[model samples]
Target chain A: MEKKVLLGNEAIARGAYEAGCHVATAYPGTPSTEILETIARDYREIRSQWSPNEKVALEVAAGASVSGGRALAAMKHVGLNVAADPLFTFSYTGVNGGFVIVNADDPSAWSSQNEQDNRHLARAAKVPMIEPSNPQEAKDFTKLAFDLSEEFDRPVIVRITTRIAHSQGIVELGERQEVPVKPFVRNPQKFVMLPAHARPRHVFIEEQHKKLKEYSNRSPLNRIEWGNKKRGIITDSVAYQYVKETCPDDSVLKIGMVWPMPDDVIREFAAGVEKLYVVEELDPFIEDYVKALGIPCTGKEIIPICFELTPDIVDRALNGKIKGGAYPKYETNPVPPRPPALCAGCPHGFVFTVLKKLDLHVNGDIGCYTLAALPPYSAMHTQGCMGAGIGMHLGMEKAHGPEMARKSVAVIGDSTFVHSGITPLIDLVYNKGTGTVIIMDNRGTAMTGHQDHPGTGKTLSGEETHTLDLELLVKAIGVKRVVVTDPKNVEELERIVREEVAAPEPSVIISKRKCILIK
Target chain B: MKNVIFAGVGGQGVILASKILMEVAKNAGYDVKESEVHGMAQRGGSVDCNVRYGDRVYSPLIPREEADFIVSLEMLEVMRKLEYLAPGGRLIVNTEKVNPAPVQTGAMQYPPDLREWISKNVKNALFVDTSGMLKEVGTRKALNIVMLGILSRDLEFTREQWESAIKSLVKEKFLDMNIKAFNLGREYN
Candidate 1:
């Protein structure tokens, strides 16, 4: 076994590469973006790109898979929400090639607007959700996930958290395999899951699930470690490590395969131990499933139902309150609290600071500038999702009246502007609203590890794509009042914001600056 | 040999400090493993990095109350992660404060007298005037690098090894300025 240190995301990418994945598509989101980035950069055999959105990414990957190639699609937890429309139906229409949909979950909202646990999606879609505890498991589980996908003729959700996605660990490397591409078996009855085809597949899915549960029980990924069998804890992902650290002596069942929990194994383990505690990040999926089987197990009751788990949290729950549970005390100085902020030289900082000075009611989109909604630069008014800024600004003008609405504007980053912001700008021009859209063009997708966007003239594989110029794009959208300003020039930004805020009709302002990452 | 946990909001360069430490330890020929959180590309959010060095490394994970060095780039984040430092561990902090969105929105309370709060809870701590150092260095952007310089003295790596690692990290254009920043940081302690 050749072991080399690799990022968790890179390891997953490597695993897919070595597994002979042929096509991979993803929409850039935190934790998940690097999976595609690494594949595009290092794995020449896989065709990869950042699709327009999560739904499109999954659809494209599905198409590739249907063509009898191993394919994968990736997105953040929220991105899955956007792709849910396709995901639910895709379960009915199984895959010809091994297809894996990667959901990189942000449990503690570390870099997300909201902390969403995606295990619910797997359960709702009736798809198996597999989570890896570390970089090694991340790679191994990915390979297993594809095999399960092909075996069941279904899509598998490879769920990962912030820690597993970003952490670096020594992983054993493997030689890339060469898999011959199979021709797509275009049987209308089998390929197309119409109500007629879906009924049998639906029944087939239930049978598949029963077999999957048995497979989950038999799989080596789900194993029981015997230390002390008195107090049992069943955990998965990073939480397994925490449980081991906190209660190393306890009989622990560390699950590498997270979802479609093995009920028989859990019942046997729960019966053997005096008390069992289920440990998982964000949700009580296993605990609830175990309890539903009439097995009394403690999970979210003793552990927090929110956020990621740590040794401290586990120690407090397992021992501190119950004697012999207190972790070793560490004396620390009570340092002051400091929150994150935009860099002093960050162009977005200046632009938002100017917007606050102008007292413009700025509708914000997602990006590093989301910080502008906080602190001294409290400029952003409403923030929902990407591209909502321009459309929301127009809606505000219609609701707040044309005269007062002239003070309304939408502030967004250039990469964000391309992601979903362009449609709203087109909507504004067509609907005729007295609103201004400020595009903070920071050359790079700064928040998601400085990956390039369509506007940056770079593709996911670093190949040049057709660069979408915001200026020309806005003009083409039929916006007449388009002005590009340097965000670093706070004075100019303030003046421009004021001018556009008082304008009689819809306008576009492009605040162009190179990102700090690029610099 | 000690495990250091760097905690701060995203964009505070907490990860960079850990990365620099990893570089120093690697250059010093000590076994080291550094783990950092990725995927916070949207806003200023919680971020942490773990740097461990010793005779041999088993896992990249850090346990509760096990960190020998606790670097607090942000105040609340420091308190949030203080439980990770082992007894007698050193706490290095930047005195400057930036509040989170919730605090600014009045949805959360901003802790008052951060140093005192930390001193009350933690046994040993060092406060470096990082904001002042950054201003004196003539670049607020260099605050993270400056803190690394201060950490350099506390690190186990030799001065030459540290310098060479830092030198190889950046372009030549900023080398002189960064050297000045590092020296200024070293002098702060």
Candidate 2:
């Protein structure tokens, strides 16, 4: 076997391929984006596509699974919230050919709006969850997740953090093991979740949970490493690596399977050590569970509940120096702050520059276009998650009337508009509100890397596909006035935008341009 | 084990330079691990990577004050990561100054005595005027490779090995110019 250095996300993609995944679908989000990108670029055997949003991505993968093909969906931690509607019920329906969902979490909110721990979601959804400490485990656990999903007849969640997802480590490559796809059976009772069938399916999910809990107790994934018997650290995922590096002599209970956590195994490990510490990032999820089992353990009190934990932080926390602030201190001159900015020739720059000159109240959405909030082009006023711009613009229009609303405009990317912007755009027309919606169609999802979307005219595997016409779509949704203009024509763009916003009728301006970095 | 910190602004190729070092270390048959920041931060923001190599590496992160060498692509980014340098650690810094967003927006000023302050603090600081060297090469993008060339002087890898690493990493179109820039950096005082 040849060894290759790989990022944790790349390793997960490799694991999915080697596990014989038939289809992979995802929407690009930090840390998790590369998983699908790697699969799309490297693995031609698997049919991979980037969905409009996380919710649609999960549904697409679910459809593949129900049709008797192994499927995987990848997204960032916050993206899970968008996909939660399908995920909560998918647990009850199980799968026909195995399903795996990768949730890349951010502990310090690095490159994200929040550092949400998705392990709780896995527990709430009653799905098996695996956490990998390094790139090697990232690969192995992904393959294991698919197998476990099929074995337990449920979808498995693989939770990763920024440190694990982006860090590089050596991994041994393996040949692809293609699993024969099972025939898709038309069983309405199992697949369809009309309240009547869902009632029985919920009971089946409960039964599966019980069996999984039993399986977790003796599973090889959760192992106990012997060291100094006095102190034992119970941790999983990236936190486990920090523990090992910081306290090498301490006994470790590395829980690879994070959910339905090997209760008996944990109890046995606790009994042997005089002192136990549950080390995990963000929420004290494992710490809370261990305490629930009547196990005395030290956690958040000493470790500090916020931010990503480094090896030095962990060591100082355990040694009681953290409270005294006994960390490395250096004397140096003050450095200039380097905040992220829009690229030199970014098409969004023109729109933002125009918006600032016009002094328009711009409602922004997620993606690289969000950078407009910074620096010389501080054009964006309100940015509230993905797909919120259109609705926020409509709400402001209805509350303040057309005179004030004419000064406000919603700015969103092409992919984001395809994601959740459609419903809100329709709302603008149905509610009889007059607000200008500027779809900054960069021709691709520029943020989290240029992954293909419905509007890109290409699939994730680089195959030419049907491209959505933003102008036609907006007009079809009952927006009487819709105009398409190139962002490069700054003079024309500013003139048209001014005219549309003051029209006293709902309108859309599709500012068309390709991302400078895409080519 | 040796810990190296490569620090610079986003577009300086700091990550790529560290990655090249990682590959060179791996080729030398030493266990290696590295960490880098990606995604939103890559847009002209301060970026750094930790590259550790030796018999074994448990953590990708280098502990505070544990870095054996600090390779800085920009002067200010060097100050930001000064805490990562071990006492008596070697510092190979490019004297190129990049005005960050605040300074460019006139909200902040670049510290005037940065070079004097670095000289007063560090004992083994080797400062090279990378911008001047790149002027000879006729391309500013080769600044990272030039800095790597200066750092290679203290490492155990042969000259051929360093050149081979550069050859593998740099694009074919710009290979000869980068090779020349690396050599010029190596010969600089």
Candidate 3:
């Protein structure tokens, strides 16, 4: 085995290669974007591509899995929300070949809108979830995830927080195992999820969970460490690393396979110790499960569940004090904050400057353009999730009148426009409402490290492909007037926006400019 | 165990410096774990990296007041990460202030007498005057490599190891310039 210091995301990609995954797909979102990028760049064995959005990514991977090939779809926690439709049903219609989805969560909203706990989603869907503590487990557990998914014939979710996804450590690398793909047979009862077929498969899934729960109890993923019998701590994922370093003397159960609770193992460990505590981050997922098992465990009550846990924070929670005396760093002067800003030559800033001048209530979508909402150009007023701007603009127009459309405008990125913006734009047109939507056609997903989108005319692997025509597509949606212009020409953009908002019909302004950061 | 932080603005080459440090640490048979902020938070923001090295490192994150060294590429960045410096920890700073967006826009003023604050508060601080050195290098980006050179003095690593690490991580065309910057950084300490 070769030893190398690899990031947690790189380890997952390494595991994907070693497990002989056939298809890899994703929509770039940090702390998880590198997983698909690594596969596309280094591993030629796997056919990897970027889908328009998370839903398309999951569907692409799902298609590969049902056709008897191991597949992987990795995304941030919010991206999972986009793919939840497939995730729920894929549990009932189990996999012919192994399928794993890496849900990378951001605690403290580091690069996300919310630090949502996705382990609950795994429990809700009755799908088994695996989490790794470090780069080493990030590799091993990801390899194990594919096997567990195949064993239970279900799509597995490997949940990871930003800490685990971004941290780099020494990992012992192993060779790739070219596992043969299972043959697809004519079995609609198992593969197809119509109401008639899905009902019994639901029962089949319930029975499988019973067997999976039994396996969870005995699975090597969940291990118990015997230390002092006085204080017992139950934890999973990166939090397990903190618990181990903070309270080495305490008896602890490290839950690697996060879902199913590993009931028998949990009960066995709980019976061996006193003053049991569950240590986790963001949410009390394991704590809630342990309590429902009728086991008295203290969690979230004392241990704060706000952000990621460090060793000292874990010690302070577990032992009622810092490991060492906490030294107060500063006394009088407060350090000024250094917030992120758009690049010096950013095209988005120019458009937002015009909007600020026009005094339009801009509804901004996610991307580098979101920075326009900040100082120097406080143009954007309301902001929401991906593709939320267009619909919210429509809602405003509907409640108010055509005057509202003239007063306000919706702004979206090219990647997000395809992600979820199209349907909403169609909704605006079909409802006979007038709302001016600005599509910042940067030709790449700039916010998440410039990954290729459908509009970029390139696949995830850097292969040339058909570029989706944004202006034509909007016109086809029955948008009466569409104008394509450059934000660099600031005066004309201002004139165009003023003209479009005044028109009674729905109008689309495609501010086409290549991202400056992209070479 | 050694915990070092490279703090600077986003475009200041802090990430590349941290990577080179990790490479040097690994070359000296030390296990290294480096973690840095990415995504939306790092777009020309206060970017800092936590790099820990030892026989067997457990936590990639350094708790407050545990950093052995804090190498900064800009003047104000050192002040921002002062809390992470361990007692008697050595600080290597580039005595150059790249204005943050708010500062540049005149909403906030750049702290005056930053050098005075460093001298009064820090027991051992090496303020690297990269003005002339940056001129020779013909770019401000190589300042990170220069800061890395000063940091290399405090850590237990050989010159050959440093040279090899820089050579391996850096591009072929820019190797000579980065090596010159590294050597110029060593001339101070």
Sorted on lDDT, highest at the top, how do the candidates line up? 2, 3, 1
List model 1 lDDT by residue over A1-519, tens digit each.
Answer: 666556778888988888789999988898778899889889989999888778889999989888899999989999898899889888878888889998989878877878888888998998888888777778888877778899988899998888788876557788887766779887776668788998887888888888888988888878888767779999988787677667868999877666788777777788888988888778788887888899888888888978877666787888773222123323343333345567558888888777777677888988888878877688888998777888888887777778756666788888788778878888888888878888889887887767777888988877878887789989998988899988878887787888887888778889898987684
True contacts kept of 3: 0.53
Q: Looking at candidate 2, what TM-score does chain B attain?
A: 0.95
For model 2, state the Cα shift of residue A5 in Å.
0.7
Question: Which is the winner by TM-score between candidate 1 and candidate 2?
Answer: 2
Query: Is 1 or 3 the stronger prediction by lDDT?
Result: 3
Which pairs clash (backbone N, Cα, C closer than 3 Å) in model 2?
none
TM-score of chain B of 1: 0.92
DockQ for each candidate? 0.23, 0.55, 0.55
Write one digit per residue (lDDT tens) for candidate 2, span A364-466.
9988888898878988889877899999998887788788777989999998899889999999999998999999999888887777788889988888989
Estimate, for each residue in B85-120, the C-alpha lDDT of model 3 and write its tens digit.
888888888888888888889887777867777877
RMSD each, Å? 5.5, 2.3, 1.7
Clashes within 3 Å, all models in order: 20, 0, 0
* Worst ten in a row by lDDT for model 1 chain A: A321-330
**Candidate 3 lDDT (Cα, whole model)?**
0.87
True contacts kept of 2: 0.63
For each candidate, what TM-score against the reference? 0.82, 0.95, 0.97
